[model samples]
Target: MIVITTPTGQIGQQVLERIVDSGKSVRVIARDPSRLPQRVRDRVEVFQGSHDDMDVVSKAFAGAESVLWLVPPNPQSGNSTEYYLNFTRPACQAIQSLGVKRVVGVSSLGRGFGRNAGILTAAFEMDALIESTGVSYRSLRMPYFMENMFHDLESIKSHGTFYMPTAGDQVLPLCATRDIASTAAALLLDESWSGQDSVPVVSPDSLTPNEMAHVLSEVLERPIRFQQVSIAEYKATLSRFGSEAWVKDYMDMVIAQNEGIYDDDLQKVQPSDTSFRTWCEEVFKPAVLAP
Candidate 1:
């Protein structure tokens, strides 16, 4: 049996879609079963509740061979470490208790990446804790998500501009969530690999925020600019959006990225599908260019 957590989320939903279509015996843990699509509900055994709940995961892990784990983002979370691990800790216990062998988890690049790197640090720690459990694990160490660009939809639509806390000329890695989900589905379905490892899902193409602005402008047929904001200004922006709880930690994370914490990670993994231009044309342009 293959168990998936957060099946309704962006990555999880795609993973569930691919897995269910293969006609595998699948189960999911969700807080609200109604959020699941009608077809999905009909297909998989649903254990309704947060996967953080020991009882919920325990039930889902029963007779389970492989699991896809994704920790939902808690933007207002006070401590990224606690927020991530608290949810993962229970599953670690359950993995040992249930004798489950394989786990494919969504994680970030940089293991000892940077100081005060909020959720990234939390993700690095989560990898450590899970590995200690002696379970065969594949941690998809992802870079900046292109889908993260969508968070700027309103900014793009209104002003033809987007913001980030990085040097505008620095070439950095990026990937789409679709690639991450596709890779996860491939891993979870096979059950052929074993042992703990971190897999980098980085793109072959690297671009600066300035270059991204040029591509976005050409694609949308408008003048779009990339604005490099200060860490304090970034915090102010987050605060305005009611995301102040982890502001300091988030600030450190962006700084770490700009500092090139994952330069080694980028060199490690083969580039998967999805390019920046493709995402801009297919994903970003439509939302901003729509009537």
Candidate 2:
């Protein structure tokens, strides 16, 4: 049996879709059964509760062979590192006790350079905790999501521009969440790989935010450009909705990216076929054009 955590989430749901289609026995742990899409509820056995709860994970892993593990974002979280570990520690305990054979976990790129990297730092630490369990594990380390571009839909429609703290000329790696899910699904379903290994899911192209603007412009047939925002401005924007603790987490994350935390692993293993332009045309356009 294969188990999935965060079953209704962006990456997790995609993994669920891929695995459920394979006709495998699947189970999921969720906080709210109602939040789950109706189709998903029909297919998998549901273990309702937070994955952070040891009881929840223990029950979910019962008789399970593999699990697609992920920590969903907590915008209200005060500390990024603690937030990730809170869910991970229990999972490590459960895996060790349950004798589950394999796990595919979603994590980020950057090992040495990611220290003090805020939210990403937490993700890396979670990887270590799970690896320590001696379970067969694959850490699907990823870069920026191509879907992050969707945050610009409104501005692109109104002013023909997208914004970020990165220098317009600084090219960064990008990946589609769908590709991450595909990697996880393959690993979770096969059960062939053993031991602990980190798999980098990086993009083939080094597309700068400005180049991404051009791609969006070309695909949407509109004038668009990248607006470089100040890191201070980035903080101020996030501060409106998040506590100071939460704001600091994102602030450090941006600084780490600017300092090239994941650059080394950005182009290794399984360069994604999904391009910025393709994602723009397919995913971004539909959402921006939606009423």
Off by over 4 Å in 2: none
The per-prediction CA RMSD against the true structure, in angstroms, equals: 1.4, 1.3
In order, candidate lDDTs are 0.87, 0.87
On the 0 to 100 scale, the lDDT of residue 35 in model 1 is 92
Candidate 1 lDDT for residue 284: 77
TM-score of 2: 0.97
In candidate 2, list every pair of residues with a backbone clash: none
Put down candidate 1 lDDT per residue, 30-120, tens digits, no spaces. Answer: 8889999999999999999999999989989999999998889877778888888898999999999999989999998877554667768
Tens-place lDDT per residue, model 2, 111-184, is: 76836999889999999999989999999888788878777778888999888999999878889898898888
Off by over 4 Å in 1: 112-114, 241-245
The best candidate by TM-score is 2
Alpha-carbon RMSD, candidate 1: 1.4
